[model samples]
Target: MSDRRDVWITGIGLVSSLGEGLEAHWTALSTPAKPAVDETTYAPYVLHPLAKIDFDQQIPKRGDQRQMEPWQRIGTYAAGLALDSAGLKGNKEVLATTDMVVAAGGGERDQTVDGAILTDIEKQPNPEVFLSEQLQSNLRPTLFLAQLSNLLAGNISIVHGVTGSSRTFMGEESSGTDAVRIGWSRIAAGTSEIALVGGAYNAERRDMLLLFALKSVALHSPWAPVLADPKGVPTGSAGAFLVLESPEHAMARGAKPIAKLSGVWSERAKRGEPGAIEALVDEMIRTAKGDVSEGTAILSAACGAPEPTSAEVAAISRSGLPVRSVTDRVGHSLEAQMPVALALAALAVSKGKLFAPLEGETLEEAFEGTLTRAIVTGVGHWRGEGVALVERVD
Candidate 1:
């Protein structure tokens, strides 16, 4: 049971509150990053549960780091590691052959000041200056290219000397999976040889933090026995990237592949309850090779929603795979879900281990593990954007 459209993931990179670089993040996620105590009053969202690199410790050189916004910094760092993993470095072959596609729920958050725009506006002496001034004043540099959804792609192309098609798509919650789909499409279409694809979002922003706090969507306690309160869900930022290349291309380049994207499917429900994820999950398994019932471990996209969590559990119930939730360690990263989850799943495969959620966690009862298959479920609210199913074949 093989298909010619196989997309192999030769490389992966992650920048999250859990840590930076693949190894650091891999270690942090396997361990736990739970906060010491529950302190809901002190702006509960200000910090992340765990991160191996002291962000400040990895200071960016004056100019290199200064130009990037905080959120953008996380993504750029992650992209660097991903390329490194692919053994593509800042080399000419990768630059010449790769096209890029980035996905995100929301573009970069602009923190740039208007000093430059204001100065330019002030320089105009014409009466129309005021009108143009108003428009220019609105342009802020800190957030400038750094905030653009396609900024990283543009930067990557420039840095790597890539001249292929580069673009960004907004898939709300499905951005991560969609990014992979698009990359796959391009590769299949012969539009590009290698595709750099992924998504990133900084959920720790003061506004986003406050918003989640008000929504009471985050778990007060992120570890085991997460309080039943709906408000207990925690959120964090992550940048995860995967280099998708045709099997032929990767083998030609002598790339050591981690997993092959054997199949990708997507769908949207006209109207339904939160558990609509069941159908999506079912499709991924039905199309996968071999028995979907044994030794399968599910890496769920449980963003702390009981309905969707139950929905995915029901789907996996049929396939009979052990379900594991990594969000417990990495926090809820909306756009970064696919790459991060897949990366962790790949690591688990590499190490021959299954990650257990915190004790007394609700996910323990949902999966079935025998010895033949490993299925990781990634569920999210596309909020009407749609859902995608990505199969990782070893």
Candidate 2:
């Protein structure tokens, strides 16, 4: 049957504002971080908790650390953990055949101008002093390479010697899910044996902070009602990835199945559409492998917005599956949310526990039904896409 080609999530690695690793991220999301104002000296934007990976331990001894942006570092760290989780450290064949895919909203856009050089060119107060300061500021002629969105995938391929297809997807907040969908399509069509698909985002730059400050999306107080306030958008970094393998390959290699990506569906939100979520969710349920009545729970990408959240609720009411808002714990991780939500679903099925929700957060009663299957929904910004994936454990 067509369902025989199962896409199993074999490993997961995550880094977020909460901390490193899956446990730390889970804890950080579960327990809110203290608030800070935007444009802090140490790092821009203090109101929302920032997810950052410690770069000190990962930098090369003699390489130019400044050349690597924070987004690159985050991607590298998370990819390493994902490979480790998948037990591919020393596997030559897997490394040779594996495909690398990066899903992100938009890559970093931080550029620093040499103050000393500009001052010297302008010939400030004291020529001798200006020249001395400029010379002291590393006057070596070095090539400057602008970081591209594809650099993350390129670097990953170079490090791992993955000569297979290397690509990236940019879908605003839905990029992570879109990347996985691409990876899954490749594996399903017998393109590659294994795929590394996830997303990484860093909001530590001045421009990103200023943008947030201008939008007023950054939560001013940790005590702010994130759910109640349509403006409570937390700014944090997250790298959520999954190592997907075909069912036949996994079973042949004696690898246990974590959870199956039974189906992935997406749709663009039309302007002025009132029931976009309902339409997309209904389509997914109608086309699901298993009956919609068997669906027990749903992991939704509500994005903490009132309209989208209400739309999700209204959709679940029609699907008749209990829905759990995963974004509540992980925040709105943009492109990284796809793999993050998938990882959470895998954990729930692998551990055989109905994952708990934060206090005072209640899903609609219709989705609260007792069943063995669940659907996870993800929605991006106003013009972004809506993605849904179905998972079941009996």
Candidate 3:
């Protein structure tokens, strides 16, 4: 392990309800303010809407912008921001070999088409036939093409020119966790000198709300801190990406590291079995605790879903580390959750402090000491569990 190259996080691009870029998010989270929530838009279901952003600033060509879906646009825009942050934008020489890993879900649904079919199918005598006909007629070939999960990587490559090896992972929060893990592992193993990794989610869709509502995991009106109200998750629109580089590579490019990525570990637990999640979480924390001395806290991506949230809380209490739930501020971003948590963890370690705790959350305690390292934890709403250690470079 000592012989492995040290991996550092040099650039971070984060866009959430708090706003875009690191400065905007840091200021908003470190201060005393309410989470940007839209309660009435979804009616009975709460969500964190994305802030208005001028697409031209990041994605210049109108033609390029028009072809991408909202999620793709968000990802491409964030990827550009990360390249710019690392001083790698338009650096054709470096970008030609930079690897990219993306975590994403399927494309947004055509709500109008879906609505029409649902409304009309019930009235038809032959409901199955009507549905089949509608599906064949209403769906466009282009719409199906847009649903490819790898398109986010393609768009980033086209717009940002990161033409290196590309990989896309699709599962939910686990995908985001694995994306970061693989990117860091590659850099540390000397297989890749630099890599871009992250994911995005658009939570302002009725289809997404309906999907969660079906599972009864969609948070309703009157948004409360996720820790205080561990009943359901309020999805938020967000995009998060990080530029990871080996120490040698970063120094060669004169890119300063914001924080050191010490380690990343991921696991899956059988939720049907009692103590399964708790056992994995405890093991991960025990392993991560070996990397720090003191002044370490946890940044948790514990979505407000009841089971996982409670399991994560028990593990945090056992670890005896002060913790803050990232979901409380940004909302549950599904595939983007782990990347968002890591970005914020790196930001916190770089600044030497943790952000303020949510107003009504009794579980989150204030940390008055310098933050030397942060352990970011992501317990998937249903299946996956992961943890990563982020520490100050110096």
Per-candidate TM-score against the hidden true structure: 0.77, 0.77, 0.95
Write one digit per residue (lDDT tens) for candidate 3, span 135-215. Answer: 688955246888788999999999889999999999999999999999999999989999999999999999889888888
Which candidate number maximizes lDDT? Answer: 3
Q: What is the C-alpha lDDT of each candidate?
A: 0.59, 0.61, 0.90
Candidate 1: where is the Cα deviation over 4 Å?
Answer: 1-3, 29-42, 45-61, 105-145, 160-162, 188-191, 213-216, 221-232, 272-277, 283-285, 288-290, 365-373, 382-394
lDDT of 1 by residue, 1-394 (tens): 3334667778887777656766765565555435232235335343343244443333335465676665556666667677888888867866676877777554443323333444555667774766565557564433545566676666556544556677787665567667777787777666667988876777655545544555655455434432222234456677788888887888887987776554444455433665456776676656552554445566665566555555555775676555566666666677677667767766666555565445555545533233223454555643422223334455
Q: Which ten residues in a row have the lowest lDDT in candidate 2?
A: 30-39
How far does residue 142 in candidate 2 sit from its true spot (Å)?
19
Tell me which of candidates 1 and 3 scores higher on TM-score: 3
The residue pairs in collision within model 3 are none
Q: Give candidate 3 regions above 4 Å deviation.
A: 120-143, 291-293
Output the TM-score of candidate 1: 0.77
Error of model 1, residue 257, in angstroms: 0.7
Candidate 2, which segments miss by more than 4 Å at Cα? 1-4, 23-66, 110-146, 212-229, 285-295, 364-372, 390-394
